[model samples]
Target chain A: MDINWQFIISTLPLYQKAAWITIKLGFWGTLLSLVIGLVCSIILYFRIKVLKELVEIYVELSRNTPLLIQLFFLYFGLTKLGITMSETTCAIIGLAFLGGSYMSEAFRSGIEAVSKTQIESGLSIGLSQMQLIRYVILPQAFAVTMPSLAANCIFLFKETSIVGAIAIAELMHVTQDVIGMYYQTFESLFMLVAAYLIIILPLSFLLTWLERKVRYAEFGN
Target chain B: MQNLGINVLFEGTTLQRLFEGLMMTAGIAFISIIIGSFLGIGMGLLRTSKSRIVQFICRLYLEVFRIIPILVWLFIVYFGVTNALDIHLDGEVVAVIVFSLWGAAEMGDIVRGALESLPKHQVESGKAIGLSFWGLYRYVLIPQAVRRMLPGAINLSTRMVKTTSLVVMIGVIDVVKVGQQIIERSIIKVPTASFWVYGLIFILYFIICYPLSKLSKKLEAKWEN
Candidate 1:
């Protein structure tokens, strides 16, 4: 079958819009997950009484199950309970919750990597617990966890594609729409793959460089 | 509980259908993992090649597959390539091919990391002992790397199992699809059938994956020790 280069070319705006939606989902999802992860990690680190167990259960369930199922559970399952939300809202919430589970683990390890002496020294210097965490532990923990966090972000970005399954019209969904419209599956799918590569390849390189910078800073380089 | 809904999963034929779907999921994951291991091992070995161009090409393959979502890859393979080639492949076959592509990329990275993390002296010692390349890898490098590769490979297998859920999007009547069908059919009888159906799926997956993940963690801890 001959490829329709022109059709693919004309659909650039559609692809761009879908790519933007994907980026928006990924950006907001990462931010939300980061917040949730940080809080969960801190609670677990301190071994907060009942909350720690609850967080562990959440993390395990999220990590163990497929993201598709989680998305479906929220989208279809919740609707059955008479709680309704837009597909985009559900997608963002599901992605964040999924990302949060993995991110919390990364954060926990990062926090653990901070030496005990550092915390004790901060306390000896009359830093309040909150101030000690803010001034001392968090910066170092952030550096240590930066690489894992970046990796998680990339994973979350790819995962945003699943939103397409629930009809959210993200990049993958839009590609499906274009394919349905033009019946030019090869060109449309090729373009979709290229769009993702264009975004991910450079972002990965940048993240690697940023990780190195963080490592250097941590080592006093 | 009655107000919630009847558990369609326990109804006649429904459980069997779900089990068949579960089997399909497992079968696809197993085959894909096997195929991916071979491809991944080859790519991983090539990644450490002395030639820059070969390494670059392998890295490109790894990165492209790694970066693109499996769902997209599934569409490309199932919808795009099949239509372009005018070939009719079964959904299960397509699922295997797409998942193997993903598994290979992941496994390649794992293998490359395992090999690279070994001390240089190990290779040097093998060479010093006059072992050929095959002999060196068989007798020296592989045995050490296998231990390192086990946890990652098993972890990838579990991931592949989880990811096979996406095949439903490609029209595979896997567990998720079967659950969707059940919900669609039972919606009139039980408005909340989705919760029961999907909740069962979630538990079924948890039963399979939770143990594998636990095993992976155990192996990782053992390796660290």
Candidate 2:
């Protein structure tokens, strides 16, 4: 496999810019999804009437569809309805729309895992509903949900690759651009794989460490 | 925008093309699932084997697939390998190969989870009955593990189906690509064609995946009870 190291070196700046965009998308996408997920889970836990069912339908619709189609629909389809967004905006929205449901599912499972007896005890101690959820339920659910939440975070980051489809200059986009320009397919792919590994491996370790910290604090094991 | 009726969806054999695209997507997903299941079951069995080397290899395979996005893998097989090695491979074939490998890795993990979740007594009873290792897996372990594996397997199948859309990136004319084509052809005449086209594709995917996901959930709930 003949790899052009010089070509790859020349393209480092392009990749750095693309990687920054990817990182930005991942950051914003994960944050939005987390907020959306937490809110939806809270709504479900409280059993809110119309909103609860709306959240359920939203979750199913988003989760059942692929992110690529979602991006297309958002970036291409929605423009027909006179709602326009920049590619990055559309990508972020697409990521959150998909990731929110998965994150909500993770959080819902975590909430369900909080034993009924704990909620009852918190209520008996005169904690209001909001306080009960805030102090008693969410902390435990957050701890139990940490692992899946971390997984979802990584999933969202990896998913940023799809944003390249909508013309966003992310890592995959840059890699493809390099290949197209230089015909350095091997070098371009090598850089692509390396960039993802460099970002993902460290993130994976950091998240694993964070998960362990959460578990230890919660369960003392 | 006023002419954005359902007519655009049916214009010039658009639905037929979309149907063909959907079939392509489904075909890739179906073939991969079948092959991946077989390979996965073997890898999963090996993963749970007593040998440390076997376990480590399985873990490595799973992690590699897990970390990188499927799009990268798709590009590697479809473009990188073909271009770098100066070989020819159909876009669809590369998609199948990559998805099969991915599906195997994912399914292997699922199978491993299902097998490991089986209680110790299941293995012991087979041994107590003087069964050989293969006989034990055949009669006792597999029968029980299959039950536990079904829901997860179904879930994985749905995921494979969804991920198949990524094949469009490799220039495979799947449903998403078909929608794009329809939109590109009529963008000027039907200003809102993309809305209808991509919307239909979205619903098409939803139609295929929703029931499977529901079925997975149903089986999981039923089995849990």
Q: What digit string (tens of lDDT, one per residue) describes model 1 on residues B1-225?
A: 545575666777998999998998989999999999998998788887899999888888877777888888899888987887889988899999888877888898899899998889999999999999999999999899989989999999988999998999888889998888888988888888887788889889899999999999999999985
Residue range with the least summed lDDT across 10 consecutive positions in model 1 chain A: A212-221
RMSD of each: 1.7, 1.3
Those runs of model 2 whose alpha carbons end farther than 4 Å from true positions after fitting are A216-221, B1-3
What lDDT score belongs to each candidate, Candidate 1 first? 0.89, 0.91
Question: A171, model 2: CA deviation in Å?
Answer: 0.5
Sequence-dependent TM-score of model 2: 0.98
Share of real contacts kept by model 1?
0.82
Error of 1 at B191 (Å): 0.8
Question: Candidate 1, residue A216: CA error in Å?
Answer: 5.0
TM agreement with the true structure for every prediction? 0.96, 0.98
* Candidate with best lDDT: 2
